[model samples]
Target: MREIDRLEDELSPLPESITRIRKLISTLELCHHKAERWVTNIIEAIGEGDTAKGLGTRTAGELHPAERDWRDACVALSAWCAGQPAASVEIKIGGRSASCLLSKLGERSALKEWQVQRLIERIREFIGWPRSMHHGDSVYVFMEECGADFEPPGDAECPEHYREHEEFWKQTMQTRIHDTVNGEAADFSLAVAIDVMFPCNWNFVGNLDIVLGAIGGELYAAQPLTVCARNICHVPIRERMQTVCRTLQCSLQNQRSENDVDSTLLELLGDVTAPQRWLVASLDKTIRLQLRL
Candidate 1:
């Protein structure tokens, strides 16, 4: 809003009709806030096991004994979605149960968040269940393999062919790295997928986050370490950027896939704030420092 006001005073003046749009925007904001607040209340109620003010609990155990408890929780969510405040969600299950670790989901203190995530995947393998498709929890790593069959984007001969899928081509530039989170379960997958973006790229501020987060997921009870730029003023920004890039490179290599070496980074976008540029001088170093990553 402040930026819009500044722009109106400077480069472009707002038309008198914009006042109506502004009012409409405020109304939309209020409606959004109310919806969010209602959802939050439902989520908290579920966490507390209230399940919509005892609406779900009052129902006797009519569902299959195996899934009775699960149905109880779903009832609240069904009501909400159906406009009667219910857990109106239909989940397709092809396996023995809804999920492998559904029994332990509520009492989750035994496992770390990542462990639960991994165990869920492992259990799904044993039984037929939909695999976890959480992109936020998963890390993506990119790197070049030895004798990598590389193709530069917009190759002189086929520039037109690459135009539509240019971003996809860039993502295909390197193989994504992944190491199994579980040694016992061969089919088990890791949450991290590492790939090399470039050397001397400040965008590693985000890369390191993926690496560290993956490492944390792997070693659930890892010892905490503090990273800080104590003598940041004395250190050159270029050198600092290189340090981040090097850390990321080493970590990605350390976690490189032993089984599947051909996993390419499917992520289409790079960190634009610390963008990878052919020329290092144009890199946005401030984004890395400003975010304090």
Candidate 2:
């Protein structure tokens, strides 16, 4: 069976609530890392003092004493981000613990109190904290214990496209990559469909899948160890950007059938009737396909 079709089949029998819960958990994990980093930066800034302005380049020996100190702090931060792994982020709220290892690089450790406090504040701002916090252990566990929350917008129900989805996002991306390498017709247009839907702030339906596809394509196309400056500044951003851009273009050009990719994307504009699990699954598949390929 086609991998995508297999995924669809596997998801076809699963309950929606279970799928949604799993997806929610995955998202919360991502949020936790984001919160951790934001807090780390704020704490570092405070420690250096006068860091209201962000890190700026300065010649080695050409800064006021305070500026020098700030610069040194900034340098240390760069090193940490480069060196630290994503999984290493840990959030301890009272007695709860939440952590993820996506970007794990070197060691595992907690930050200073000031840093942790700032991270907590950023996280609170991120989820709108206490207000958005659900009362049950499910919500609290993912947050206070897990350290983040990536729940879908509560006001709207999850869409139809995601109805029967299963498998984690990372796995799905790998699968999509494999399909791409195997020369399947779906990968190309799907990638384009995603980029078309979701630009930086462009939140179209099923955008997450497109982003994963683009990432997969880029990673495959680029030289090993290409750096993503905006996402991760340790390496060359241009190469990474180029890879994603190329994937976007490739996806756009390769429609699965006679229909144009743009037209396919537009069909859902007024139609909010589709299952959201499908969208989520598609994205997960796209990402996994890319990595595997």
Clashes of each: 22, 49
Model 2, span 122-230: residue lDDT tens: 2333233244534342131111111112112223332243223312221222322222222322232221222122111112111222232233332232211111111
State the number of backbone clashes in model 1: 22
Residue 73 deviation, candidate 2, in Å?
16
Tens-digit lDDT string for candidate 1 (1-293): 34334433552343333332222223221112132233223323322323232223336534433233223223322222233311223332222222221322233232223322332332233222232324433332221222221222233221343345444333333222232221221111122122222111222222223333332333231211111221122223434334433333322344333432222220111221111111111111222333233
Give candidate 2's TM-score. Answer: 0.18
TM-score of each: 0.14, 0.18
Which numbered prediction scores highest in TM-score against the true structure? 2
Candidate 2 regions exceeding 4 Å error are: 16-21, 25-31, 34-124, 127-293
lDDT, residue 211, model 2: 33
Error of 1 at 155 (Å): 35
lDDT of 1: 0.27
